[model samples]
Target: MAIDFVRSLRGHPVRPPASGIARRTSFWQRMHVDPWLLGMLLVLMCSGLAVLYSASGENVHVVTAQAIRFGVAWAVMLVLAQFSPATLMRWALPAYLAGLVMLVAVEILGDVGMGAQRWLVIPGVVRFQPSEMMKIAMPMMVAAWLSRHELPPNWRALAGCALLIALPVGLIARQPDLGTSLLVAAAAVFVILLAGLSWRFIGVMVALAGAALPLLWMNMHNYQRQRVLTFLDPESDPLGAGWNIIQSTTAIGSGGVWGKGWLEGTQSQLEFLPERHTDFIVAVLGEEFGLVGMLAFLLLYLLIVARGLWLAGAAQDTFGRLLGGGIMLTFFIYVFVNIGMVSGILPVVGVPLPLVSYGGTSSVTLMAGFGILMAVNAHRRLLPR
Candidate 1:
């Protein structure tokens, strides 16, 4: 099956060389399962399991749970990929509204974990981070809203879009999950940018954002501020706020050129690196596989991003293009922020490393985004005039 899929991707007709050969590409092709994209995702998931096993102190249970989560996420991706772009767009506004209601519910009656009220649990049923839904909903909402109007939206339209972006972002930030708020905000902004908002307005917004930094800093929680301070001078409080970064950098540096070998990272093995199974998993990868491994992982990520952008560009309608582009950019932000914080280049904001990190919410949310990307690609031909 894999061989035939690869051949089909390469533009060869899927045929048996002998007589009585049956072709099998139609279903997958109809479902819009881009072999390259699916292959990359599988590779990342496999590598994630390997790193996660080592990070979890060789815990079989942890790896099993992660594998199960990936299975669910993959199923979701396949199902979502089967939808046409128009079908997705039709659901956009409702999804956004439902997400907003969930966010509001969180504000009123959410569960607190790790000092943040970010999850809403239904009695004996399900619990999830509403903010994760925003990661997809914001872009879809913005894209749909913008698509209804003109290209290069005027200042009035931009203001409406800003309001659309701001509502959930503000709600998430109030939950004090700054990392997610920023990610959701960035996704919506990407949709606006792709919609061709005028450069003049963009410049003014940028300048305003620069000026607002001080005010934004003032509003941040003390711990958030401490993260920034710790990022600047981790040595200032080596035993306190700086411990995670110090250990992460140490793990990365000790890996040298070729790494210490799989499951042999002293930092993670010795339990010196915090969150080794989650946000700081990259450090585990760096320690176990070194620069070579990190680069290889990044190359896979690059291919996914490139393909996402290509799908966005190829999309026949404004909504598909904006939504696809937004998802791609948001995914990039997740990778950049995770790698940056792990490397001590960016302040810690608790953003997980997409698929490679051991987390259920982010994994599902990210894969769903990819599913939408696939939908955009697959359903482009069916887009309405």
Candidate 2:
């Protein structure tokens, strides 16, 4: 067979048949994978594992467990990517509804942890946060709704969107998880903005938000209010409300141009830095990897965001475009909030550092959003022959 093929190719440059070429091209689309996006995610994931090992005090068990979670999350992302855009759109409402029910369940049946009722448990079966589900569902819900309606939504559409956003957000606030509530609301708002919300309407909403601040302040929990105040003047209660920010800033600042070297930061290694492995993992990365490593990691994240937005634009349908944009922008918000929180520029609301932060549900949710982006990209209309 080899000799015959070699003889057949004599006197002409061999070329793959057009069908074979298409088969090669369509393999990626068939599998619903985006190579560039996947490559970036892998870099972040691997970098996260290295940083996590140091942050967790070089504990094998901690690293192993995180590795397991990444495994599961990676599988979930690929599974989500296998669906087409229409199927995803069809799923949007039901998933949103299911997420709402889960939020309500968290209110009644959830376990209390730290200071919030955020986790739902089934004894040895499984335990997870319900609000994380909203991270994906919110954008899906709003995008599906907006895709069916006009651009720059009308009053009725806006009201419908608000109602959709408020249900889960209200339930989450009752859980008193301000961090999650803000993220969920942010996801929904991004979708609405992508629906081509008008500038005049945007200004009006901004003014309304400004007016609502007082009411919001009045409604905040005492601890929540303290967070805001502490953000303004952290040293006022150095040992109490201020410890986290103080310690975090110290860790980042002490890093200098080049870090103290991996696992060498006194704040984290000495247990002075709060939530070192989770919400403030950035401080760990900053301390060990220094300015160069932090800059490289940030550039990688920005590339992922840029690519995600480009995929959204490449999507032929309105639903894919809006949903994809919503997911990507919300992802950027997560990175911003977590880094800002740890750096003391924003109040610590317990937001984690995207894939780098240690957590099962959060990591999975972030990956699943990328999966949706993959699906949108893969299922796009093929070009004419």
Candidate 3:
């Protein structure tokens, strides 16, 4: 099969008709499938199912539903991986525009769920988060726009890109979903950083952000501010606003070195921990599998990040490099923020642990981003110098 693929790439005609067609199709299907990336994802998915079962109190139905979501996401990943980087670039602006429009639709016609207006429901047909689409579109749009010019973009270009990022981020934040908004903004920033923006400008922006912290604090909703305060002192209101963080930290700390073992964790099974199957699933992992399991999960995550960076570096074009790199960095942020929040090191925001949390939208959206990364890698060799 490998020989046949090489021959096809070299413009050699195959003599065996049936075998040639079958092999050619198989090769093409497998072409964009990065072994390391796929392997890591598989491991994470299996581990997620195991932990989710335990987190949900050994509920087979919960794990079964999550498995279905993973199946759909995996199919979407493979299908998306078939597109060439050029094809993805062509759709970048339109995709971003579409996401923005959906976000607007969400603001006006979106359904409220669990105290947030983030999902758009199309009557009886479909319901989904528009912000999830921005996870990919935002970075792609920024990369596409930046690729049109020289690296170390001018102030004007930076400003324009910031506006592009700000629009959806502003809208999503108004949904009061600080987590998704931060993720979207970070993804765009990764593109800008990869595009070689000026360090002086970055420093100035950071300083301005620091200066505006007070104003930002003042503008935050009461619940949002309470989260920050709870992060600083979870003991201040241990049975009230701090219950989630306190319970999470206890679950993590009680696990000691080797964990309580599988479904034996008292905190999660007893319903002491909050969001055991979603945002705080890592705490369940920690309590059940201990520090060793957490370390192993981090290793797999790091390998995925490393492979993504390698692919981004190997890409032959600016768009591929920026888009691929941005996706990888944003993925890293997802892991870091989720782990930090679970361990009580950061304010609790509703960022789910990628691939390891029992959620449909986030899992699907993340897998699709990897699909784009695979597309970038698979098409790199086809590009001319």
Candidate 4:
């Protein structure tokens, strides 16, 4: 069959077959198959396995649970990426609205954990974070909405986008999960920025937001205020509110260049580091894998973000571009804030390191965001009939 086709092509100097009386379908399909991004994710997952093995050394159950989480998360990403952007667009608003309802529900009847109301329980299953859904859904909703109109040259669409971002942000904050709230808001902001909102308007918004910080500070929970103050002067409460930061910094500093080696991290092994598997997983990486490992982790993040941006830039439509760009930048926010909080450069706010931290909701959420990006990339130039 192959020889026959080649022979057929020989006539008239191999008159080439022309494209699309039927609109070539391959371009749309091509974006959905992202081996590079998927490979990076696999590497991240493997690194997570190594880090978790050390961090969860004494807690065998922790390793088991996390393995299960990673498996499920990868599966979710695979399943999600198989869908087209049209399918995702159809779900965006409904998904966002559902997430919003859940967020509101969380406020009314949430299960409190470690001084935060961030989880919802379903009988016989695990309690998961509703805000994670908001993170993904908010961006999709905003992107879908803005794609309907031209870039927000007017205030109304911009305000609508802001309102969409803010409602979930306010709800997450009310749950006292400032980290997730900030992330969710940032995801929507990424979409808004990709929507081409004016820089002058953005600056004015920033100025107004900064002006309101004092009032915001006044309304913050006592512990929340202490975290900000502690970030500025960690020494002020050495044995008190600042213990986590102080210990995290000590672990990172002591790691030196090559680190203490895997499973040999004194701070993590000796249990001096709190939340070593969750919010502060970086301490384990710093203590064991050291600076080299940290850089590797960062490089993975950089690659993922760069690829996402490239896809967004190549997208042929506003929705695909905004959606891809938004998800890409949000991933950056996750990397930045998680590492910043763990390194004690920013307040500890329970932000999980993407693909590295051990949380079912978070892992799935991050993967789903990537999956959406893959979908957008796949369908950037084509429309689904």
Which is the leading candidate under TM-score? 2
Residue-wise lDDT of candidate 1 within 194-230, one digit each (tens)?
A: 8886778789899999999999999999999999999
**Following a full C-alpha superposition, what root-mean-square deviation does model 3 have from the true structure?**
4.2
Clashing pairs in 4: 31-378
* Native-to-model Cα distance after best TM-score fit, residue 82 in candidate 3, in Å: 0.7
Q: Provide the lowest-lDDT 10-residue window in model 4.
A: 12-21
Q: Per-residue alpha-carbon lDDT of model 4 for 136-182, expressed as tens digits?
A: 89989999989887666467788787788888899999988877788
Q: Candidate 1: where is the Cα deviation over 4 Å?
A: 1-25, 381-385
TM-scores, all candidates, are: 0.92, 0.93, 0.92, 0.90
Give me the runs in candidate 3 sitting further than 4 Å from their true place. 1-30
TM-score between candidate 3 and the true structure: 0.92
User: Per-residue lDDT tens digits of candidate 3, residues 119-224?
Assistant: 9988887789999999999999999999998788987888899899889999999998988998999999999998876778889989998999999888788899
Task: State how far residue 36 of model 1 sits from its true place (Å).
Answer: 1.0
Candidate 3 Cα lDDT to native: 0.90
In candidate 4, stretches whose alpha carbon ends up further than 4 angstroms from where it belongs are 1-31, 381-385
Winner by lDDT = 1
Give lDDT for model 2: 0.90
